[model samples]
Target chain A: MVEIEIDEDACVGCGSCVDDCPNDVYQMNEEKWKTEVVKVEDCMACLSCHEICPAQAMEHRDIHVAKRLYIDRKVNDVLDKII
Target chain B: MDMEIEEIRGTFRPELIPKETGGDIEDYEEALHVLMKFVGSMSSALEQVSGRGANAIVYQAGKRMGHDAAKMMEKTDNLEQAMKEMGEVLGVEFYFEMWKPSDQEGYTIEKGNETVVKLLFMDCVVRQTLRRTGLPQKGPLCYLLYGYMVGAVEEVMSIKGKLDIDHVGPNACLKTLTIKWGGK
Candidate 1:
């Protein structure tokens, strides 16, 4: 399981990660360019955004299946509506 | 310069490189134009529209006097606090933003005693609101301050390779700057 982290200060609000994520895990907040983790759990272990991000603002941590999988499933539940 | 020592230092990542392979002088100028506009837009949006002027105005903060109360910070001492109070009165702020190429993964540079992290592009903005205080314009001081920042950044870039960091445009309202890496 993977834990996703996004640095609000580092994020440029480019929306690249939002578009690239196949799992539909991120969304842009209205006020700022930063992405809000509306669905933390939907992350599919795919690191496309991690590799593609130009800002070096995103990171992931590998964790036990129990802790990691919970966020992944929780996020995916919300992903259906936004994506 | 000796009397005033108020300063803040920062670094940005991913050294910026030209998108094109080779070009003439016009190309270089155009690149700088694009870079300047990019930084200016970001700065204007943050300074003018964001309602975060206090944060953006670094120099103004330098002149502040007689502050009421705020929690003490461990990292800062009394003298530093006093200087900060003065800064608050002056209404000065320095803001920096950086853009860099992703492939290089960013790097750092060392100057006399400073180490600067390389960025694709870095913009150091100095906003001074003097309020027509009958004081001589501090434009030169602002330019000099930013010049030091650029020099530090260039020192870092030079270690990796020769990059030409130049002041592209200088206007009263704003200035345009750019650092071009690699030779034509």
Candidate 2:
């Protein structure tokens, strides 16, 4: 099962994830005015919400993290030395 | 900086096969990146020149490839079996699986003469190529996979099929495949 964690302190209640998720995995908490994971079972780990979220307040755990081969390793090595 | 190219000298004969490929992992990585950039440039240029027709052209090309790839596979009327076979045909690079909501009883839903199934593509080469060139999703390149899946299903089941993109993201994408029963 996929577990979702939302950082309420960072959440601006923008509801972008709620709007972006195709599976309705998230819903806005009217009382807290923040986002909450309602249906985590339907979450497909697409991570589109992370892109749309301005605050980056959510994290999905124990899901298939797709391979990202686009990142250049040589560029990362230079950045790693500088940082 | 200048780099030296290592040349391999080997005698080749029509009957004899080479025991090893000369390239290393770095060579493959560089080749893959170059191919991605080339494909991305072609896709973008095609879109710029042909507009929406570029998608159809790419889709047709992908569909033809899919048909050729699936030609040797066993034919079946079962959608699930065909999808499993398609996973093998697409191999690891285009890894995908059938998806459904928690509340849904099954992965597939039937309506009238059509059966719909949600496919969650976990790893797609098209998505990777788009990211490599900073191209947005749902562009002309994405249609290639759409046509590929539809073509494979149609060939396997002898039925008309279509794939619609429901959502796309950096990590994954969701698409709905609809298969219509009866003769093509």
Query: Which stretches of candidate 2 lie above 4 Å from their native place?
Result: B1-18
* Top candidate, metric DockQ: 2
Docking quality tier of candidate 2? high
Instruction: Kindly report the docking quality category of candidate 1.
Output: incorrect
Task: State TM-scores per candidate.
Answer: 0.24, 0.93
**For candidate 1, what TM-score does chain B get against the true chain B?**
0.24
lDDT of 2 by residue, B36-82 (tens): 99999999999999999999999998798778778888999988889
Task: Score chain A of each prediction against the true chain A by TM-score and list the results.
Answer: 0.66, 0.94
Each candidate's DockQ: 0.01, 0.86
Cα lDDT for residue B108, candidate 1: 38
lDDT of 1: 0.40
Chain B TM-score list for all models:
0.24, 0.92
Model 1 misplaced stretches (Cα beyond 4 Å): A63-83, B1-184
Clashes of each: 38, 0
